[model samples]
Target: MIYDGDEVEQELCVDLYWSFRSPYSYLALHHVRALAKAYALRWNVKVVYPLAIRTPDFFKRMDHMWRPYLLIDTQRIAESLGMPFRRPVPDPIVQDPRTLLISLEQPHIHRLTRLGAEAMLRGRALELVDAVGTMLWDGSVDGWNQGDHLARAVAAAGLDLQDMETAIARDPQARDRLIETNEAELRAAGHWGVPTFVFRGEPFFGQDRVELLLWRLRQHGLQARSN
Candidate 1:
């Protein structure tokens, strides 16, 4: 869908997503918000699990090829965007809390998605989601075991993480429903990947494709284009 810069009075909304463990997602997180603001668009963060969990063997094999590409591509993107990119001291997923690991088999996916939903509900979705993304990507904070990292990030977006945690703990069903719905929605979008952007029902997979979506938005004035 193309968004007309001139005609649209209301902000064009697009879904922004990422997997907590995805380095590419981390890279994309750095500039997605600024891009949205520049285009007068509203970003709707939709945290989803990486494709690795869905197809583990394929991901393992792909990782052999992808790791190098991930490092190189992210560095290039960081350079182009003038953003600082460093590999965090401790990997977020590898060093996560055991209790957290037990609570959610994929803690990164589950926690991110739950937080995204909560932020959406509270009307601070974009900001909170962006903060979380920065935490994951910026390389300043070791996201793995920063003690109060999540809480601080949430609070930075003006949310009460303590309350959010209480709610999530009290309502497992809610979190499950949100995750199930997110997965279903993602599948329906024709790309089972994080850092996917959906504009006017058309799915653009990968951070590299954001510019393509922007071009389409400018050209089509918010109308969906079929592949």
Candidate 2:
């Protein structure tokens, strides 16, 4: 491709549609943060509610093999990446322990998505999610939603938990709207999964596709950030 001398270079942007409950989303986040650091790329991070919320019947509709496969796959991927792995003790989404049926009244995930939206509004979505996701997904911490665990994580992300909580308290409807918009865009991009990265309308759906997203960016002449 030839560039005209007077033509301005367009900034490279990637849209990340992520969910807090997905282990793959957590795994992919580590790579996404590294990519942001190494390149002069704009990350449009949108935290969408997990499928458990958006499509309540999704798990019930999935193949029986999927659950076992996901358990095996996520752990192996974490091992391969040398990242600590553990399922959140109290799953973010409420469900029947024995039947694996999701409950209608969810207490945790809604709050998490609201906070994630607030972080996105503050333009520190990646930092917030990285810190919080680590706390929730990594084997290091238990009862992540208890005490100062969340407050410390928010502070680590360079955000104030009280301030964000206040924002949510003021207008939680607005945060849910933001998440809805992300979900719509994710579907419009031809996918419905978390950790999906969209570059110029093309969707790369899955943690394994991050490399392909990078390759596409390179084809568009993505540049390294200057020191």
Candidate 3:
């Protein structure tokens, strides 16, 4: 099935519930990019605040083995995908590792989320996320949010950072509400995980489920490029 944007009845859309602080999201960007570029569809990225902020006690009741196992498993997944794997510099949370008490001074996360919303509005969200997430997740760049890093990122996405900031500042409540609304919608979708892809109201959670998503897309007649 060749997907051309001409037919309204043929439109295929996917809602991507994503987070800035998720390492999986950073790793999943390439696959998302492929899906967006390979098929004719509206990629509706519904950005959400990281779980660390939304639910501070989320990790409090977890089994002691969760974090270490997650790191080991995620590292293997990154290696399998040939992606660079590293924790974000300065980390996204202001949590004390020993006590796991998250601080409220998360200056970066909120700004990034708002910028993501702005990027989505500009129709270059995946580009912005891929560019910025790479810088933050990899060791190549220092101070990922400092100086020209953000400018360079938005520029790569063909967007103006100052312009986006100005717009977001004008109505900060709307951006916050958007994140809140995405979280609600994610709950309604029956999962609260990053890198979840929703197609026709069906939820495919995890970066591992990307192949399943592509299979579903095929069933929906998603087009493949001949060249």
Q: Which candidate is the best by TM-score?
A: 2
Error of 2 at 16 (Å): 0.3
Q: Can you rank all candidates by TM-score, best first?
A: 2, 3, 1
Model 2 spans > 4 angstroms off: 1-8
Q: Write the per-residue lDDT of candidate 3 for residues 31-131, one digit (tens) a residue.
A: 88777777776778888888898888888978889889989987888888788878877676778888888887888888999998888777877777888
What lDDT does each candidate get? 0.68, 0.88, 0.82
Q: Can you give the lDDT of residue 58 in candidate 3?
A: 86
Write down the TM-score of every candidate: 0.79, 0.95, 0.91
The residue pairs in collision within model 1 are 2-217, 2-221, 2-222, 3-217, 17-195
Residue-wise lDDT of candidate 1 within 1-227, one digit each (tens)?
33445665555678776666676777776557657546666777766655555454444355455666877987888888777777654543433333222222455556666776767667787778667767766767864345888788888899988787778778767766766677788888887877788877899988788779878766655433232
The lDDT leader among the candidates is 2
> Cα deviation in Å at residue 129, candidate 1?
2.3
RMSD of each: 5.7, 1.6, 2.6
Candidate 1 Cα outliers beyond 4 Å, as residue runs:
1-7, 95-109, 220-227
Clashing pairs in model 2, backbone N/Cα/C closer than 3 A: none
lDDT (Cα, 0-100) at 19 in candidate 3: 89
Of the pair 2 and 3, which is ahead by TM-score? 2
lDDT at residue 115 of model 2 (Cα atoms): 91
The clash numbers for all candidates, in the given order, read 5, 0, 0
